[model samples]
Each structure stands twice: as C-alpha cells, then as structure tokens.
Target: MKKVKPKDIKGHIEYLADDRLLGRMPGTEGYKMAADYVIDKFKSMGIEPAGENGSYLQDVTIRKAVTGNDATFISRDSLGNKSELIHGKDFVIFPNAVEKQTTLEAPLVFAGFGISAPEIGYDDYAGIDATGKVVVVMRGAPDSFTSTVAASSMDIGNILQTAANHGAVGVVMAFTNPTAGVPNISRGVNSVLGPDGGIAVSRYYVSDDVKLFSFISGETLTNFLAKAGLDFNTSLTSLKNATPVSAPLNTTIRASYSSSHEDINSYNVIGKITGSDPLLKNEFVIHSAHLDHVGIGAPVNGDSIYNGAHDNASGVASLLEIARIYSRIDAKPKRTVLIAMVTGEEMGLLGSSYFAKYPTVPKQNIVANINTDMPTIIAPLLSVVALGAEHSTLDKPVANAASYLGLDVEEDPEPEQNRFVRSDQYSFVSQGIPALHIKYGNKTPDGKNNLNEQVQVWREKYYHKPQDSIDGTFDFDAGKTYVQLNFLIGYQVAQNPERPSWNPGDFFETAR
Candidate 1:
C-alpha cells in the first residue's frame, strides 16, 4: 500500500483554501470552482464517477427562507392582558420554509426537553396534552442519557417532529442560559428541496401543521414562566434532574409571519473505487467530507473571506489522499468505496441529508460511513475520538485501525460540544446507516495531553473565520496520519464479509 504524504495533503489544502474560492459557499461560482477541482482530481486518479447520470455531480436544490418584517409575536394572559414582544430583541422567528405566510394563536405548554424517548424511560411529553398548543421547550436532554443520545434529543428537527406528533401547532425554544441572546437568523434558514420542489429535509419547519417555530430570549422566558406562577430556575432544575416538570402556562401566544425564499443550486461530488469480490462489491463503504463553508462575512482584522482551511479544506484534502492511496494499491478491498464531497453542510447538513435520503446507489447497500470534518490537525496525532462509533460494530474497526497506527483511542473530552450530531455523519446516522466521524482527541507529546486546551485557543482565533486561511496553524504530518487512520478503518469494513451492524440492543438499532 502506498503511504499518504504530508506534502500532498498540504498541496490539496493550498488550492481548496485559496482566496479565489471565496470560501466555497454553495450556489456561488466559487463553490462550483471547488466542485470542478474535486472532479478533476478524482478523474485524474482513475476513480469512476458515481454520481447522477454517471457524472460526478449530485444535484441539490437549497431553499433559503427569510422572515419578513411583518412577523409579530403577542402573548395574552388568561386575564385578557396582552404583551407584544419585539422581534429580534425578545425573540426571533424561523421562516416557514413551506408556506409563504403563517399565523397561529395557541396556548403554551411547557414540555421539559421536548424529547420522547421511551426506551431510556424518559418522555417529556408523558403527561402533557399539547393538542392545538405551542410547546415551550429547553435545549437539552436528561443528564443520564449518553452523549450521542443527548445530542439527538436536543436536535431541533426531532424536537419539532415530536411536538407535531403530539398535535402541537407551534414550538418555542427557550434559551437554557438566562444571559444568552436570541439566535441571529439574519442570513435566513436553509432547507433541502426534493425533486418535486417540496421540502425534503430541514432542521426547522417540521411540517405544515407546525406553523410557528421561534426562539425566545432566556430573560423573556423567565418572565413568561413567572406569569404562570412557575419559577424558571426551579422548572429548569426539575427538568435537568429528569423530574419532568410540565404544565399549561397562563399565557397564550399569537404569532404571524411571512417568509420569502430563494432557491440555489448545489452539487455533491462523488467518486467510486470498485471492489474485487463480486458479491461483496454489492455493498459499499462511504467516505464523506463537506466541501462548503460559511462564505464572506463581516470583515475581521481587515479580511472578509472565511476560507475554511481547517474547518473542512483539510478534511476534503484527507479524503483526496485516501482516494489516491486506493488508486495506488494493486488489489482493491472487497467492498466498494465511495468518496463523497458533499455541499451545503454549513447550511445544516443539507447536501449529505439529500444524498443519504436519495443516494445514487441503493441506500440499503451502504454498510457504513466514515466521515471527516475539521480534524484540527494542529498538534501531533496521538489519540482520536471516534464519534458515533460506539453505537455500532464499527467500533471494532476503529480500535484495530488505531492500534495499527499506534494512536490511542479515548472518550470525547468535549462532550458538551454535542459534536456527534453536529456534522455530516449525523445525516447518515439519521437515515439508519451506521456511521462515525473521526475527531482529534486530547493527546500531546508532552504527557500532559492538553491538546484540547490548545485547540480551544486555536478555535477562538481561526475557527470559521477569515483567519482560517491556508496560512493558519497546521501540522501536515498529523493530517497524513489522520488519512491513514480513517482509510484503514474503512478498509477493514470493506474487507469484512459480514456487513457492519449496530451493536446488540444499541439505542440506534432499537430506535430504527
């Protein structure tokens, strides 16, 4: 097998992160340039096109919804007193992706975390009858739940669907931190549109029935809860302790909003390497990385382009190197390998979700996905955290690969970040396919292993900013190691006869 070279990884990043790409934001000519670059590289490597119509491009239509100025939110108490809240100050409304205009007037029901997972013996909607009402929920799960499960529980899409399933007309997500401000939706919300021009997947706007989805400031929530004779802190404490505090609020909210949408075209670049075994070749192992980033933003330090060198340029580069390694090998793995550089990941994993839902190949034939995003290869590659791997038999391959590479495998040191469900891997996991994302762990050459601390400093400086250009901090050797580690893990799965399976009685297995 040919070894991955650090210089090659650097070369790929140098081009992808160049200022000419303009951060590779989807729907822009710069993004098309990046897609063309990937296609050209894949073609040169002899990788077969595995995208739509035998080409390397999968069409994705992204709909961006912006809330109109006519949006209004008014809270009326049972005593007939009304208080109209200011938009963008007290709260911010999420644009209705499906409907151009939406209006709703309903009573509010506080449903602790808005999670309905009975397998874990925790259901926030247990006793609450949220019929024809708006559910007010905090953003968190019970402390006892596993990291991945907790992240899934707090997912906005799941929360909205759960609310809709219970006959709720709307949802209001209250901030957990009293000092936290309402989310800034100035750039509008994004959703994937199906071939029929309907919503295929979205983090917001669950369905037509769920008309209103908004976020309230933590201070405003405290006042709202107070009107119902409930202390916000006490209710939050009870919910966090898994005690399930829910009730009908004394206040009813009336909200009206108009949404305007702009549709943009994007693409997911895909390449394939056929397997050697005839039967095993039917199944595939996916290697995915996002090729998009937050475009030009408010200038910082006199720079505007948000070149995502470490955010994902490095990740895409790693996948390129992995593809090259396969090209240099004489004998291929038993199962096919699909290298997917998806777009619209920065826009809420839109590209990956679309591909996962409507893959070029049969969805069931896909056994596992190994995703790479923001490896943060600034320090020596000493340890790794295989996010989402523990939920399935993919953990074995991760262990074997780590052992082969002499890298330690450790638990996520920053579980509070909710990283498992934050990236493209979650898109596959949501579709019932086993998947995992490789992330840097807290390990360093010096025994202190305080790499996480260093990463925090780096993140503050360059993460998602113009400073994230190719000139940013980088350890190319670490990038080379990451490529090898991820390639080995996927190679083992491709060689194995039995398809990778979810762990016995795992949450994902039973849930699916």
Candidate 2:
C-alpha cells in the first residue's frame, strides 16, 4: 500500500475550502472551478472517464424556489373563533409542492406519530379517517422502539408519504424538539422532489403533491392539544410507551402559499479504474463523496464564507487520495472502481439520487458504496463509527480494517440524529445497495474526550460556519488516518470476488 502524506491531504483541503471557491456552491462559478480541478486530477492520473457522453461530468439540473411573501395561514376553533397565524413565526410552509399557489381549508386531526407499521402492530393512523382533511404528526418516531422500527420511522419522507396515502390533503409537523418555536427551515429549498429535472433527485419516486404542509410552533401545538382535552406532555409520554392517543382538536385550518422557481445546473464528477479480470470488471465497487457545501451565508465572526473544510472538503480530499493510491498500484484489483464527487449533496442528496436513479453503469452492476461525509479529527483516532455497518456484510470488512489500524469499530453514538437517512449513503440504501458511512469516533481509545466533548464543541462553534477552515485546532495526522480507513475498506471490497450483499431479511434488502 502506498503511504498517504499529511501535506498532500492538507493541500487538497486548503485549495477546496479556500474562500476563493466561495464555499463551493452548486452551479456557481466557484463550484465549477472545483469540478474542473477534480476532473483535471482524474485526467492527470490517467483514470478512465466514466461520466455521461464520454466525459467526466454528469450534469444535474437544479431548481431553486423562492417562497413568495403572500403565503398565509388562518386557524378556526370549534367555537367559530378565527385567528390568523403569522408566517415565519407560527409556521413555515414546505416548498416541495409543484403548484406555485395553493389553498386548503380542512379539518386538522392529530395523528400520534404519523407512522403506519403493520409489521410492528403499530399504526398511528389506525382509526383516524384523514381523507380530505389535514393530519398533524410529531416530528420523530416514538422513543421506545426496536432498532429496525426506529430506523424506518425516522425517514420523514416515508412519514409524509404515509400521510398522503390516507388521503390527507395537507400534513403539519409539530417538532418534538422545537427550536424556540421557529422551525429550522433551510434558507434554500433543498428538497429532492418535483419535476423539470433539477438539482433534487431520489431513488424512489415519492408524491410531492401534498400541497399544504407546515410546521407549527410548540406553543401553537400546546394550545391545540389543550383545546382537545389532551395534555401535551402526558400525550407525548403515552405515545413513547406505544399507547398512542390520536384525536381531532375540533379545529379547522386554512392556508395559502405561492413560490417562484428557476432552473440551475450542476455536475457530478465521475471516473473509474478498469479492472484487469474480464468477468469481475463488469461489477464495480463505488467510492463516493459530496463536493458541494452550504455556500455564502449570514456573516459569522465578521466572515461571510461558510468554508466547509471539515464538513466535507476533507471528504473530497480523501477520495482524491484514494484515487491517487489506486492509480499507482501495479496489480489492479479484480473489480472495477468508480469515484464519484457528487454535487448538491448539501442541497438534498440530489446528485447521488440522480446517479442512483439514472446510473451510468447498470444499477445491478454496483456492489457496494463507501461514503465519507464529515470527518472530525480533533484528537488521535481511537475508535471508528460505521453507520449502517451491521445492516449488511460490510461489518466484518470494516471491523477488520479498524483492527488493522489498531482501532475499535463501534455503532453510531448519536442515533437521535437519524444520521442513516441524512447523508449521501441513504440515496444508495433506498435503492437496496449495501453501503457504509464512516466517521472518526468522538473519543480517544485511552478515554480522553471519550464523551466526545470535542466534537460537540466543534458542532457548536465551527460546523457550517466560516471558522471551519484550517486553524490551530485542526489536526492533520487524524485526518490522514481517517482517509486511510476509507482506503482500506474500499480496497478490500474491490479485491473480493463476491460483491457485498445486504444482510438476509434486512429492511433494505426488500428494496431489491
């Protein structure tokens, strides 16, 4: 194995995260520069181009929506009293609807957690008839759940689809963990939905036609629950215990929204190393990373650029190093290797979804995907967290890689984040591809910072902020090690004759 140098890794990060790249926003000139750099690197290494049209770039068209100011909502109680709810304060509209302007006047019914799982004998919408009405649900699944059920329930897209299947005209989400009554709406419409072949893409085609969607404030939700003779806290506890209590608040809601959209274009940089074995070359082991980050945002600490140095610039840098290492190897692996630096991942996993739905290579030919999103290397790595590791046959390989590095591989520490559904790996998983999303553990092996306070501090201080750029706090050695782990796992997958497969009877296996 060729040694990867810290300086080489740092150099790549410095260039990609530089302010001159303007945060590498999708479809921007800065992002184009980054794409050009990736393609040039692929060419210089003599890696074969595998993108559409005999090029190293797959075009992903994007649509940007700007919500108009005319959006409004009004609430009416059973006693015939009307109150207007202010937009941006009481609620925020979901922007995925295709219609530019829509209005819905319907009754709102509280649907415990909006989950319908017959396999688990739990259906939140069981006795509730939500047809031609509005359905309100809590943001997350019940706290008490089996690991499998919890994973499925955390997929919000699936939750909304279930609500639509019940014939609900609109869906309202009440965040269990409210952020000061202001829903954390992305400043940009990053949802991978709708038509016109834009930046947003998905593995399964979901209906985005549920036009009336909103997230109400905690206070608003409490008020509604009060009128329905349900204590908010008591009801939440009951739901967590699986004794769901769903009822109508004897209230009606009226909402109107409008938005304007524009077409934008981005690219996914792709290249491959052809295998020597004729038969194995037909199958590919993919190494992927997202290149886009949240572009310029509100000024923070007197700086405007949200340079995603650690958020993902580090990840792309790792892919480049992996590519370099594979290109220099004398004896090529039996199976082909694909390198994809996708775009609009920060937007909504758009680039990867597009690739998954319209793969340049036959989708069946893809064996496995290894993804690196954001790697935090505050201290020397002692542990590795492999998201979705146990769901497939990759656990042994990843554990073996960690063992080779004298590190212990563990499951995700913060499952509440629902990380499995958050990254680019989800795009592949939704399509039945066995994948792993790797990250450096929060604690050291010796138990120093074992609680992962360092990472918590980073999230609070630099995550998605201008301060994420390289600084004294950054550790180059840890970053190099993280990249090595990815190399080890991918190399093993490419060398093995049998393609990685999903665990028998796993939820994802059903996708196949």
Candidate 3:
C-alpha cells in the first residue's frame, strides 16, 4: 500500500482540537459537532455507513447530571456531639444509594486496599466481612511509590473493581500521597477543559447532598490522626485487621461543586470498506479511536482549550489515515474494515462499552481491533510500543508490519500502567475480543530499557494539558507508520484462517 500525505489527518486533528470547538465535551454542541465532522468525512470517503440505521451515526446516549448544591455527612459521637461536611468543597463522592435515604450506623471496617489476589498471596479482605459496615480502604495501591499493585503490574482501576466486588458497603479512602493519586483519571479534584480543550464531564453521577461516600485527603487525614494522638501507621495497620474494635469518631463531610452546560446527543461515527469475497464480507477488522474530549473549562495558564492533541486527536487522525489507505487500495481485503470513532471515552469509555454490549455486527467475526490513541508528538519515527502485546496472534503480524516498515517493535516502556484497561479496547477485551493498542513515535532504536525521550517530555508537559495543541511543525511520519502497520495487521487477519485468541494465564483469555 502506498502512503499519501497525512494532511487530511493533520487538518482533522487541528480542527477538532481548535479552541472555537470549546473542548469537545460530550453532551455539548461542540461534541456533537465533532461527531458530525467524522460522519461527514466518512461519507465523503465513499465508505458505507456501518452504524445502526444504515448510517455512520451510532447514538451513545450521552448524559450529565448535576448533583445537589451541598452534601453533608454528619456523624454523632457517643457524647451527642455532631459535625457535618459539605459536598464538592469538602469532598466529592459517588453513590449507589438509588433511594432517597441511606443510613449507616454499622461499624466501619478498615480494609487494606480492599484487594484480593491469590496469585500474589495478598488478600485485603482475608478473614474480614464488611457486609453491613462502611469499609475504609486506602486509595491507589498499597505500594504507593513502589508498585501500582502486585510485584507484577496493576493500576487503581484494576484494584478498584476488586474493591467494588468485595461487597464493601461504602469506601472511605485514606489517601497516602495526593501526588500519587493524581494520575487517577477518576480522582482529579479540579478539571477544566481537558487537554482535548473541550469541556469535560465527570464519569460518576452527581447529586446534591447525596452521600454514598466522602473523601478525606491524605494530608487532612494524616494531620487529624496526629492531632487525635493515634499512631498513623498503627491505625493504618489496624484498619486492615480482619477483627478490630470499631472506633466511631464524630465526623462530618461537606462539599460544594457546580457546572454550567448545554446538553446535546453525541454519536460514534462508523464507516466500512467492504471486502472482495462475498462470504467473508461479514468479517471485519476494526480500527477504533475516541473522538470526544474534555470540553471547555477553567483557564490554565491563560489557555483553556485542552486540545487533547495527543490524548486522542492524534488517534482519530490515525484512524482517518488508515481508512483512506484501505479505501484507496487496489487489492481488496477478504474482510471488511470498520472505522469506529467513539465518543464518551473520557467519560468511562461509555461509547465503546455500549458498542461492545450491543454491536451492530457479529462480535465473533471481528478479526481484531487496532486502537490508535496518542500516536506521537515526538519526531523521528523510531519504534512501535505494543501495549497488551503479551497475548495475541496480532503480535507476529505487528512484527511483520514493523519489519516491512524498517522499524523496530518492542514492549511498552511501562507495562504496569494497565494501558490495556485505560482505553476503549478494554470494553472489547471484556467481551473476549483480541485487541492491540499501539503507540507510535519516540521509540528506542536499540530496543534497550531506556525511556523514550518523548515519554520523558510528556511526563513533564503535553500530557492531558492545554499544551497538547499542534502548533509548531510536528513530523507526522510516525503516525503513518502506525496506520500502515495496523492496516497490514487488519489485512493479514482478514485473510488468515485461524481466529485470534489470548495466551495461557492471561486474565482476559477466558473472554474467548
């Protein structure tokens, strides 16, 4: 396949991430506009509308809810003294309390991390039953600075699900390090127009005075513990004990939060290039990317667009380029190629989750999913970082494509980041589909363990900030490599007789 100028993609990313678009926050006009733009492009490409209703639009049913003005968690001491905390201002909380009222006078159990991993021989819930009580768990991982989870690799989200599964009535997180918790996409205290430069919305529902749980900052909790004359480490350890005395302290939580916005329906743009063989037409090679970004928000450094350039504009751009290449190819593939740009990815991967739950096509026939996200801002195309590379038939194919491009391919620099669960691919993974998420550019040529230069730069800047905009000249050649490689992977998978599956002992292997 011949490579064309990546102008269309470059132009698309710039337009979508533009400040005037107001940070493509889903359920906003700008977000709808972004989706419309993708639909229009799909139509212009002469690709068939592969979404529902014979169109490129797949309704994501985006929604937003503003919680009540104030939330107070009041607790009474045995002496009849009482205190209260405000909502948003004091702390932000998510509630599963579907009803109007919830009362908890039960004992509060301190569960260590609320994690249970037999493979690692650690069980936070071992010998403990938190059934009717509020469970106090530490936020982030137990090994805050050391490891995200086990001596292996895991992140907060992975540990969170485990916590949620343990029937912990309410979770009170003891924040050890605020800085450590900042990387948590769900835990940010202040969010403006995300780096996507669009207004962004919170994933958890909000309601005034609703108290499913309340947060205590690490500093505050630590200070208060010191003031109360409790040995912090001892208390921390005691909380994790299976059997412990309940210390009911007079407590109160208060918070105040507000947002202003217009609501609009969002869409997932879908396009398809049909295959040559009639019998294999139903088969598909899917390329996915999220098109939505955090809409406009509070100013940061006098710039608020948060253009989400690398966060995803880069991804959507790559999707378009791949679509263009496949569409222009003279030799057709045996299976169809589906280009799906999802919305509400920043909102807990909602769009992709909906698609996975209710696919327009047969899920089993999907040969593979190539997720393009945050392609590159670094110049000089070096190598491809294959995340979730451990379990897949796509690995060798990726290697083959890399060889074809004269580029080296290696494992992700930080495999423990759980990049697998960080994007839309996880939705498919949950459905048992084999997927690959590749990050192009800033690759290590020698394949040594040294960090990619761009990665180091990204840690300091351009990561989920308004600075992600594409202003100065950026070499997009690496993006082309990503598209080409994925195109080949898809093309190869289309012709292969065997279906892709997970390797032995991989968590999602049973998803097959």
Candidate 4:
C-alpha cells in the first residue's frame, strides 16, 4: 500500500480552491471544470466509471428561483382590522416553489415547533387539524430535542412536512426576534424534489399546491398572537415540556408571491475499485465529498471569489488523496470502493440528494458512507468528531481509525447546528444507508481552548466569504492527519466481512 503525502493533498486543494474556479458553483462552467479535473484523476488512476451511461459524470438538473420584490402579505384580525406586512421587514417568503402567483387566505393556527416525533412522545401537531389553515410555527425544534436521534428527525423540514401532512395551506416561521438571522429568501435555488431537497418537505406538498411559507420576527408574531390572547414565549416553553400549545387565532393570512425559475445542470463524479473477493466486492463502501460551494456572491473586502479553500476544498482534496492511495494498493480490499464527488451541496444538498434518490449503484448494496465535508486544517490535530457516530456500527470503525492515529473520537460538539443533517452523508442516511460525517475534533490534547479559537476565527472570517483562498492560514500537516484517519476508516470498512448496520433501537434505524 502506498501512503499519501501532505504535498499531494495540498496540491489537490490548491488546484480545486483556486480563485479562477469562481467558487465552483453548481451548474456553472467552474463546476464543470472541477468535475472534469476529478474525472481525469479517476481515469488516470484506472478507476472504473461508476456514473450514468458508462461515464464518470452524473447529470443533475437544478432550478434557481428569485422571488419578486413586490410580493405582499396582509393579515386581518377578528376585529375587522387589517395590516399589510412589508416583505424582508415583517416577513420574508420562502423561495422553495416555482409559482408565478400564490394567494392563500386562511385562519392562523399556532403549532408550537410544528414537530411530530412520536418516538419521543412529542407531537406539536397532535389533537389539531391544520387543514386549510396557515400554521404558525417556531423557528426550531423543541428545546428538549437531542442529537441522540436522527438530526433531521425534528428539524424545520420535519415541521414543514408535518404541517403539510395535516393539510395546511401555508406555513409561517415565527422567530423570537429579528436577530434570529432569518435567511433572506429573495435569492435561492429550488430543489428538484422540494425547496430544500426531499429530506423533509417533499414534492408531495408542492404538488398539492400547499406552498405558502413566510417568516415573521418575534415581535411581529407576538403582537399578532396577542390579538388572540396567546403568548408566544409560553407556547414555546410548553412545547419544550412536551405540552401541546396549538391554538387557532382569529386572523386570516393572505400571502401572494411571484417567482421566476431557470434550469441549471451539475454533475456528481463517481469512480469505483472493485474488491478482490467476489461476494464482498458486490457490497461497496463510499468515500464522499462535496465539490460545490457558495460560488461567487456579494464581493467582500475587494475580493469577489468565494474560493471555499477550507469550507469544502479541503474535504475534496482529502478524497483525491484517498483515491490515490487506494489505486496504489497491490491487493484491493474485500469490498468494492466508490469515490463520490457531489455538487450543489451549498444549495441544500441537491446533488447528494439526487444521488441518494437515484444511485449509480443499487442503494441497498452500498454498505456505508464516510464523508469529509470540511476538515479544519488551521490547527494541529487532537481529536476527531464523527457525526452520526452513535447511530450505527460505523462508530467502532471511526474510533478505531482515530485511535490508530493516537487521536480520540468524539461526538458532535455543537449539536444545535444540526450538522449531521447539514452535510452530504445525511442524504445517504435518510435512505437507510449508515453514514458518518468526519471532521477535525474541536478539542486539543492539552485541553486548551486554542483549537476552538482558531476554528471560530476561520468561521467568522473566511467561512463562505471571498477570503476563503489558498493564501489564507492553513496547517497542511493537520490536513494530512485527518485525511489519513478517513483513509483508515474506509480501509477497515472495506476489508470487514460484515456490513455496518445501525445500532439496535437507534432512531435512524427505526426511521428506516
């Protein structure tokens, strides 16, 4: 077996993270160029094409939608008083549908958190019928929500899907304050399945014409609910305590929107190395990474390119190194190895979702997925955090990999981020495939907070910004460590006799 070198990994990152790539936006020329680079590498390494039609590129169509600024939402109370809520100030429409105009006038029903996780005995939509009404929901899961379950189990997707399942005409996200950082929906890419992919709110709801979605600040929501003698804070607290706080408000919401959509195309590059053993070769393990970033957005500090050097270029670089090492192995592992470089991850995991829904290989035969979305190379490696580690047997392999490098394996440090559901691996997990998202652990061996500080600095400054360039700070040595860790995990899984399975009683296992 040939070991990967730090220079080899850095070379991949430097090439993919070049400013000339224009952040490698999905469906754009830069994205295609990046895909071509990966295809070339795979072909040069003699990796067989695993994409569609005997090619290494799987074409995925994406749709971009921009909401009209003139959209309006008016609400009328029982007292016959009406108020016109300005867009972007009072409320912002969710840009998930391809509708020319949408008009929905219905009474408001406050569904606390809008979650329906029966396993946890928390059902905000229970005992309530949202049929033909606009459901007002808080902006997050119940405070009691835990990462022990599937990350998407109680997320906004679940909330919207549940609301749609109950026949709701429209959905409104009520934030506690304007500072809730509600994303501006004026610009976004609509998913082929739904706005945010089919993870939660599938195309079923959109096809049913239940597409009204708006966001309101806490003050706006509180004043609106106050007209009906309801308290937003109290409702939120009750929901966290597993108490239902759904109620009907004597108000009617009339939301109208117009949008325009343009079709776009991207690709996911796939290649495989068939295993030596016939039976085990049929069962494959996937090493995946996203190749797309935020692309070129608003310029910052005289820079216009969001190079995404560390955000995802780091992850893709590691994937290339892993593929290189695998190609050099004299005797391949017992199980086939698949390399997946997905696109449109920055736009709500669209590429990965497409792959998961319609896999190049049979979805069931793919035993496991080990994903590296973003591995911080700004500090010395101390530990590794594996998302979804606890959900399946992959945790053992992950721990073993980390231990091999004298590093400890840990769970997600910030579960509130819902990271497990944020990356490409979750797309596979939703399809009942056990997957883990690998990252450099937050803590260091000395227990000092320096590592965390460096992470924070990167996030605050370069994350999704034009400043994310190859010239920025980086610890290539640290990058090499995590890359080796990922390779080890894939090697162990590929040679193992049995496929990895979700742990008994795990929420995701039960979800499947």
- Deviation in angstroms for 210 in model 1? 0.8
**Residues 119-205, model 3: lDDT tens digits:** 444566777776645555555343432321232223333444444566544556656453222122232222122224332323232
Q: How accurate locally, in lDDT, is each candidate?
A: 0.93, 0.80, 0.62, 0.79
Give candidate 1 misplaced runs (Cα > 4 Å). Answer: none
**Residue 260 in model 3: shift from native, Å?**
12
User: Which pairs clash in the backbone of model 2?
Assistant: 61-198, 61-199, 62-198, 62-199
lDDT winner, 1 or 3: 1
lDDT of 2 by residue, 320-422 (tens): 9889898899988888999999998887788888787777899999988999888776678778888887888998789888999888876677776667777
Model 4, which residues run further than 4 Å from truth? 148-154, 178-182, 193-206, 445-449
What ranking of all candidate models by TM-score puts the best one first? 1, 4, 2, 3
TM-scores across all candidates?
A: 0.98, 0.91, 0.77, 0.93
Instruction: List ranges where model 3 is wrong by over 4 Å.
Output: 66-69, 75-91, 95-105, 119-122, 142-164, 178-213, 219-264, 276-280, 300-302, 414-418, 441-451, 458-461, 510-512
How far is 259's C-alpha from truth in model 2 (Å)? 1.0
Residue 360 CA displacement from its true place in model 1, Å: 1.0
Clash counts for all predictions: 0, 4, 38, 0
Looking at model 2, which ten-residue stretch has the lowest summed lDDT? Answer: 197-206
> Highest TM-score among the candidates is held by which one?
1
> Which pairs of residues collide in candidate 1?
none
